[model samples]
Target: MIVRPRPNWFRMLFVWRGSVLPVILPQLIGTTAFAILVTVLHGRVFAWKIPLNFVPFSLIGLTLAIFLGFRNSTSYARYWEARTLWGTLLNETRALVRQALTLADAPSDVPTLTARLIAFVHALRHQLRTTDAKADLERLLAPQDCARVQAARYKPAMLLLMAGEWLADRRRAGQVPPALVQAMEVPLGRLTEALGGCERIAGTPIPFTYSVIIHRTIYLYCVLLPFGLVDAIGPMTPVIVAFIAYTFFALEALSAEIEEPFGTEPNDLALDAMSAMIEATLREMMGEAQPQQPSGLPPGGFIQS
Candidate 1:
């Protein structure tokens, strides 16, 4: 997510910061060479007439537009779902803290509750990244419980159960009245729902058939482009083809990058920064020493959904 005040076209040129180059460079090189070949060999090794009628090309363009539109819509929906889930997590963390501190008998238990809440956030972040949560959990939870919870594959889910147990124990001990517990329970239920929603998007993706169709369509369009313009465009075919290729391929690659917002990619949502925010907010609610605000997200067209 390169965050510039204005769009940075230069970033798209000769930019080797991450994974995009490997995909874009090849398309650029191939498109450039193909354009040159068509120009130099036009009306020589082959007839320079357009391979397909403009009418057929127009139909293909319309079809490609529709497919790309659909792909982007689906991708954006997944990205939005992930962001929305995190938003719910943020509000839920705040609610959980308020409920615990305001309604619980042992206000001293506030710190422990805060710690557990922070750990749950860290656990959720790690779960999304599919990484180990040992250190984070330990920092945010009691040591023994942290080790046990971190050992699980679904750390966030495990943490949720641990949270329920703690709440149940407190209720059984008459620490929290039934009505107050119900308020906390409502938010907890929402958090669980959010968790499932995020997991569903993460685990399931746009159908393979749609992906295959879009990919094939893009390739077919690019490959057919050179032939369509060779007759009229002649020596300019390569330049035109290369530019069109760049436009189409860049859009395709960008859509793929944005489709999965949980990734560590610079362009993806700043989940790490977001988790830190939740931790800071929870700790502040517990009256702990505040951690410094995290760095801002990089400038990009779409950092979040």
Candidate 2:
């Protein structure tokens, strides 16, 4: 959702400012304490210092770099998949409107089909990510269909079925021509595909084992970093460790947040706003007046259309 490219410094310190604190705090404390312990042990007791070798540190750093890269790449894949599914939704909505206009011209069927299209958009919004939405749905659906969909377990799928039923009814009434029915089916099939894509992204994830490995590796590296640096850096160990901790831990937490792009997280894709765009565009195609602008912009400055 955050598409604008910010400066690298702002990204490190402010882009994820609040979230980074929680993730990096414990690592910072541990690293600092370990550094102090190493310094004290070397000066007061051992009277000898341990030297850190750059070759091993470089190897570890390279490995960590690869791990972070893989994590980010995986997270971005999920984000982009969500974006693609919504894009398909947009194209399908437009196609559905064109099919309706070309195939059927009955005044009675027009309003019914129009309302159903709006209902479909609202239902998909609730269905994909959360269970807390029904307000917009209630506004778009008829009392009977709205009540029925509300009672059903899957609101979006129910609405899709409703659309199918409407199309079938119109076909029976000779309202929709055979050619138009076939064209309409194309968009409906795509709608189904989009639903499946969202569900897949929501249900499946990168293996838990891989996530565990990343976390463990980061923890171990942070913990061992103090041991490697304390003797050479002395009191500077804490500051250096904290910086390293911030870099690795923040990356880990951010990747974890982005891995699931449907939720209401700060960085997740803007599915709600995207669905609203679909609804608005479909409504316009139905010859309805546009919805009034809301007070605030969508979250994360992400415009759906």
Candidate 3:
């Protein structure tokens, strides 16, 4: 996600990064051209003047804005929830690592499990984004664990199961106390819940039919807009229609971009940065030096992946 400090008012007006302008530019230009054509025709074709007025457009525009507002709100809600889940994941991972360090008697085993926890975070990030996690898993896990995770259909879930098994084995050997194991299980369960929540958001998007309806309505309104304004606004109709079209089209595009917060879009959640933060935090907790090059923040202080 684009992570630069907020720009000033002037810069904000011209800023391109993280704006929906790129995606909606073609549609806006087409709408503007249509508006210009309609205006040049004086809202007439073949000596037939279209019987349209601003009254209907004004009323419909109000309702369309409301609908767009509601849709944007819904999409933002999903984005916020996904970020909350990742925040929870980060916290729970740190908690799990701390618990293992303080409670487990096997010092060597603690590092292995901590590494697994780190691997689990990366795996979940890659899974949510549908990217390859083999390299990350290989780096973070032992050969056997890496092989098992790679072979599994769901790498994050598989890693979690392996962690549980390790705890159970430790408990069986009388290394980890029963109460500590139970304590550790709490975060593990929370991790699972977080993973499931992410999957739900990624899997179930805004309804397809609802999006189509909004899309069609917006385009219809924009295309018919110049005709409605030509009688009153004359040559100004194209400019007004284009402005209005930009607002609606940009809103629609923005909603679509943010609706799936796991993506690599400029406005999407910073999963790469988040995962890196989690890894750095966990590794620090384990008394390890930070990696020379962390993966979270890109060169421009943004997280793209």
TM-score top scorer: 3
| Local accuracy by lDDT, each model | 0.76, 0.74, 0.88
Better of 2 and 3 by lDDT: 3
- Residue pairs with colliding backbones in model 2 are none
Off by over 4 Å in 3: 292-305
lDDT, candidate 1, 1-305, per-residue tens? 44334436786565565446567888889877976876676634446354553466678878888888888887888887888888888899899889898879988867766777788878877777788878887777887888778677787887787777778888998999989888888988988998898788778877788778888888888777777777776788888888877777776776788787788775777777777778777888877887765554332212322
Off by over 4 Å in 2: 1-13, 16-26, 29-54, 293-305
Report the Cα RMSD per candidate: 3.3, 3.6, 2.5
What is the per-residue lDDT of model 3 for residues 284-304, given as tens digits with 9 covering 90 to 100?
888998664354365423243
Residue range 1-305, candidate 2, lDDT tens digits: 43333457656555553254666677668766775776667534366545554466668878988988898899989988888888887888788777777668664576676677677766776776676557876788788987888898877787788888888888898888888888889889998888888889988998898789888887877766766766667688778877887788878888888899887766777666666667667777778886753333354233532
lDDT of 2 at 44: 40
Candidate 1 error regions (>4 Å): 1-22, 43-50, 297-305
Which residue pairs does candidate 3 place in steric collision?
A: 1-303
**How do all models score by TM-score?**
0.88, 0.84, 0.94
Ranking by TM-score: 3, 1, 2
Model 1: worst 10 consecutive residues (lDDT sum): 296-305
